[model samples]
Target: MIVGIDLGTTNSAIGIWRDGTAQLVPNALGDLLTPSAVAIDDGGAVIVGMTARERQSTHPTSTVTAFKRWMGTRQTVTLAGKTFTAEDLSAIVLSSLKADAEAFLGEPVTSAVITVPAYFNDRQRKATRRAGELAGLTVERLINEPTAAALAYGIQDRSEKEPFLVFDLGGGTFDVSIVEIFDGVIEVRASAGDNRLGGEDFNDTIIEVARPRIDPEGRLAEVDPLVLHELLRAAAERCRRTLSEQEEASFTITSGDRQFATTVTAGEFEAQAAPLLAKLRDPVLRSLRDSDIRVETLSEVILVGGATRMPIVRKTITRMFGRFPNAAVHPDHAVALGAAVQGGLKSRDADLEEIRLTDVCPFTLGVDNSAPDGRGGFRHGLFSPIIERNTPIPASRVSYYSTLSDNQRNVEFGIYQGEAREVQGNVKLGSIKVPVPPAPAGHVHVECRFSYDTSGLLEVDISVPASGLVRNLVLMDDDEAPNAKEVEARRKVLAALKRHPREDSHNMAVLARAARCYESFIGERRDMVGKWTAQFEAALDGQDPRVIDSARAQFEDALNQLEGDRYL
Candidate 1:
């Protein structure tokens, strides 16, 4: 059976196509959401999901979460005398989910339709695909999480026939997508996001607000830095949840025999959160502008993510669109639910015969070129765009160039991806060098073609058109690319860490559902309710799965309890 997986930063989920319907699979804990954390024991054994999250409060150094933020980089994490690339860590998470699905279905599963942020670039997308492979599953398709959420909502509300906006704010990333439902097909007109932004920023806001109260005299210098950091982070998270319901929340920090307490107000929390909220304004506006769709044309603005639960975020969005956003689908599970719908379509289990989704590139791509000097000389290394922003995916474009000097046998091209006009201002994706039969300067023709697949991964093909010779191009710095041996070694490590068959089933489904709900209600709560959430989360980290499970149930109950009152 093929499943749909949302490999999110802070949390991850999996779903399956079953009996003409899409159902999210619960993790071993019987919860619908699993924290995307991986913990390593001293013996080299690995733990994922709830277990890993539970260990975070006590064993912060041993657990690696939020590694999704470094997916395309060369950074590696060391644990238990073994080195793991970002892809390897991600594989462990994916493998665990795969094992859960296979056990639940009582059969072996091989293929899946994974979801990614619509804004993930070529390297990030490719890294995700590789992670899936390393986890022992063939990725049949990679759909954008926002688009998946929209599809899930579209299927759930089939009666609605208007275009809507999907504002997804997850634990670690922010994505805004505008989708149009014409007849039956779901086409994503435009998508944009700040992958670096999310609920984490809100936690940071809480920290900044509490900083002054902890060290009024700046006298706590001799304390263990790590301990102090953890306490502050924990306190920040606590205070943030508190601000949801009460006008103010206080955090107490204990360092040895010393204790410090700081109270933070909701207004203070909002003020601290304003910068992040402001950063979101431009992206939302840009998404609309790029799609050429006006706010009046939007049928509804659907908020998705745990961070969106903040009142300030909701107000900002409501004011921008001049409409009350739809809360029909829980924000967290919305993406996974949508993914399940797509899984149903892919597996041909749903009543719908075909489902098509088309997404756009969020940023522009370019290559560096030298500008001519005033004295008839030329300076090299300036960037020139090849594919502009908002271009449709699964598309290709080619640009031609001539040799810069006479009898030059080789031409070098530095490629980059970003919206910036200058190459230095953009991200250097990679580069390519083409060797041609010696020709006079400006005599040799080089054709550079860039193809972006459905998954948003880029492939560059450089050819000397005159001789019809072509060479495969490499991206990023040569020193940065992983060698064959390293890739093989990492692959083997991932294989060894693949999930087994005898895991919990119901819990996986629950975790997925809970995550979806968390994403949905995150934007709606007030200060009074936020404190209870903080205590509940703290209580959840006490190691007992049952306690954590009960805490989640109570948290959901509290959210439902406050649903009717729209204070924001």
Candidate 2:
């Protein structure tokens, strides 16, 4: 079965087409949501989902969370003495979700439709596809997250001629999209977002206020920074969640033998998160401006993502659109359901035969040119737009330019993305060098065509009309990463990873958690967990499934008797 996955920054979910509708596939925990976390225990067993998330507070040094923020970057996290890239952690999460889907469907899942932020740049989109490959999934498409939300909603609430505004604020990113659903087509007119802004930032706002009160002497700073930040982040996340309902939430700060109790009000949270909330306006306005959809004309304002449950977020969105946001679909499950719908469409399900989905480029794409400034001198390094922002894709646009110098044998065209007037201000995506016969400046004009496909990958073809010579290049910009080669190697590693005995996953997870519990506690508790951890490891190594299962059952009873579910 080809499934649809919402590989979110906070919690991931998967779905499949079942009985002419989308069905959410539950994880091993028998829940539709799985925490996006990865932790490796001292015993070398890898744990993902809820187990890994719980391990983060205890074994902060060996756990990774929110790695999606570094997907296209060169940053690496040191976990359990091994260095892992963001894609590596994402691959682990995707693999776990894949297993959950396979177990639920009772079949092999070889392909998937993954969703991404509409404003994700070329590198980020490439990184996402590579991550899916590393999870042994043939990624058929990368649907934009907001567009996916709309698709999920549109399937249920069929609007023939209304414009919909989608406000998506997830754990690590925010996206606003203006869509018009009409004539059997779902078209995204414009999309905008702050890639660095999201629920995590709001949590950090609480961290900024609570940290000093929690540890007034900065005593936690001298011991371990990772642990300190992890603790603070955990506390802030709880506080952020609590404020979503009640007017005030009680918080207790802990540092060694020091403790303090404080109450954080919703008003206080709104004050601290004001800047981030303010940032929510620009993208909405820009998207509406680009779509030419006035606020008065919007038929519905859709709110999405786990972060959108916060009162301030909803208030900000309502303030932007002058209407209460629609809560038709469950925020956390909508993207996955929409992705499942896309998967159904890909499989050509009879129910969705007339449904067509289209997306738009979120940013303007162009080549750098040093043309006449309209004064006496030339305006060097100016951005010349070939494909304007909000244009529908898969799209193709060509821009022609001539050589600058006398007898110039080659022309270097720098591809950039942004709405800036100058090349330096815009993001330089890649460059293409086209060779030409010796000619004077402006003599040999060449045609450079940019083709952006549905997956948001950009392909540039530079051709000289006279000689008809053409050169092509794929964007591989991460120098510190092997990029293409590393992805292939990791894909093979994922194949091996997926081959683990599925029946023993529970036992292995418990052993990994026991190791984590032992790592976190002290005195008698630590020794007890350490002993149970050893027993479980030995039982697993004995290679008999029933014996291992029996040992796990006994050890889990002992664990519950001692520490309850605190370490589970």
Most accurate candidate by TM-score? 2
Tell me how candidate 2 scores on lDDT.
Answer: 0.83
Error of 1 at 212 (Å): 1.7
**Per-residue C-alpha lDDT of model 2 across residues 19-69, encoded as one tens digit per residue:** 888989987756788889888777766778877786776788888899999
- Write candidate 1's Cα lDDT for 1-568 as tens digits: 6788989887888888677667888777666777788877555667787666545544556667778988878898876566777888888889888877876788987898888887777677778887887887888888888899898888775553576889998878889989888766788888888888888778888888788877889866776676566667656765666666678888756554466887888888888888898888777888888899988988889888777777777877888788878878887787777777777777776476756666777788878887787889997777777777788887789888888887887888888988766778877877778788787888888888888766566788998988899987634223355666766777786777534233433333233333323322333333435565565657656758788668767765665575421110
Query: Candidates' lDDT values, in order?
Result: 0.74, 0.83
Candidate that would win on lDDT:
2
How close is every model to the real structure, measured as TM-score? Answer: 0.82, 0.88
Off by over 4 Å in 2: 253-258, 373-377, 472-485, 494-568
Model 1 spans with C-alpha error above 4 angstroms: 42-44, 80-82, 217-220, 255-259, 348-350, 373-375, 436-443, 463-465, 468-485, 494-568
